[model samples]
Target: MGYIAPESPISDYDRDVVFFEGDLEELDFEVLQKGMELGFILEQRQTKTGDIEWVARDVRKFVAPPEKKVIPIPTSTKSKANPESPVNIYPSSYRTFLEKLSDSLKSIEKINDSGNFEDAVFSLLRLLGIHSVYQYSRDAQAGKADGFFILENLAVMYDCTLRNPFEEYKKDQIENYIHKLSNKSQLTIETRKADGGRGSKTLQIQGKSRQVWIITKGNTRELLVYDSIKVKEVAIKDLITITIEHCRELSYDAEHLSSKLVMLGD
Candidate 1:
């Protein structure tokens, strides 16, 4: 017994070889080719006992979906403010950089690159005076979240997505991140100093007093709940606003931002 290719025409059969039950004439070439392309073709065989048999072949072709064309969103332009204003707490150069960074984060096209977006968010968190920000690798394991940060007594595990609301925020993915968070009772994170020195320390998380936040460009609201764990949402715009406010006034610390997040959860 031998398998025949689906694309082989029935008319090209050897005259001496006989087909079982004269089924050759009933075979449709177009249907066979289409089925083969779709990996659904079945092979017909004849046993030594003159019995006809059909067997499925393990042949599958995976076709990737077409790439999506992302149209760049127009970034909002902020008017220039007086550099000599007393409220400007940062240097002129740093203030200009913060404004540009804010504009970049707001643009959909810029944040679409996950690596760049995560880096920007990490920088923003650091600028907001949250000293314990740890960014995970982009190719982190299944249950790992994008980044982790501490806010006073609160420990936040966050994932950033620039996609449409609820599109990339699948329930399974949220559950995975929650599982990662639940496993950690305490974490040791490394911090870098400007003098090119590195240091590590452990941060204790008080029982289940942790939060999983999805930072997105879309509307901020409660997204999902699994078991007793509630997954909350926060808009990136809110984070940018807090950063700007913190730049102008040092009082908008991580504790203040943490309170704002808790209020959003309510």
Candidate 2:
């Protein structure tokens, strides 16, 4: 990831900033290249007093990579003797990652059987390359959502339930979940002052609205209501498939993969 400081005079910025110092001179070419390969860029710090400073931001936030280059379609093999050989469209590392993830997801039944669905799901998400995921939870007394995961500026709030009692989930339940997640919370971030120094800024986690999703092994239509709220539902196996197929895709674009969701329903 890379970030660019806004183009403005240092005199107009807020003062009283604090930030961690790092040495760029110590980095080798391989280290820098690896960082770039992982979709990161070095961002110049906005401090007025320091020499040119740089920080890292997630590349996906600022850069739009060409789809064809990032996700090529599978091509047929020329050799007939081994026609069954898999065609890898993405990088070898990504392919291997997906393979391992698929293997783990293939055992979802066993995972649930051992009463480890939540842990297994969390592990699967991490394996599928979702960074900074929180374990699933619901605090009715505290009024918090079941769970949430972040992707840049977006937060996806979700609830998980088993297949048998899916019909018991209602619109009011979904509303409560959304309401709980939308509550206010504060986060501290580094800011630059006009005098070339830094300060901390406290911002609310409720800055942006979140998307809602439901994970289950049951029918999604059961949650349909008369109200106009939109929700996405996915069966466990379908979630695994979607995660593997578009693991690199941002959570914001998940709706585009709806065609695959129907197939999983079959």
The Cα local distance difference test for each model comes to: 0.59, 0.48
lDDT of 2 by residue, 168-260 (tens): 544566777555454446433343334546555454555543456677665444243223223556567766776776655422232243334
Each prediction's RMSD to truth:
25.3, 13.6
Model 1 steric clash pairs: none
Residue 246's lDDT in candidate 1? 63
lDDT score for residue 175 of model 2:
73
Return the TM-score for candidate 2, rounded to 2 decimals. Answer: 0.43
- For 105-174, candidate 1 gives per-residue lDDT tens digits of 5663356786677667777778766777777643433445667787766777787766675645456778
Error of 1 at 16 (Å): 99
For model 2, the stretches where C-alpha displacement exceeds 4 angstroms are 1-100, 113-115, 136-145, 169-172, 182-207, 219-229, 246-266
Per-candidate TM-scores read: 0.52, 0.43
The candidate that achieves the highest lDDT relative to the unseen native structure: 1
Report how far residue 60 has shifted in candidate 1, in Å.
Answer: 74
lDDT of 2 at 210: 47
Model 1 per-residue lDDT at 121: 76
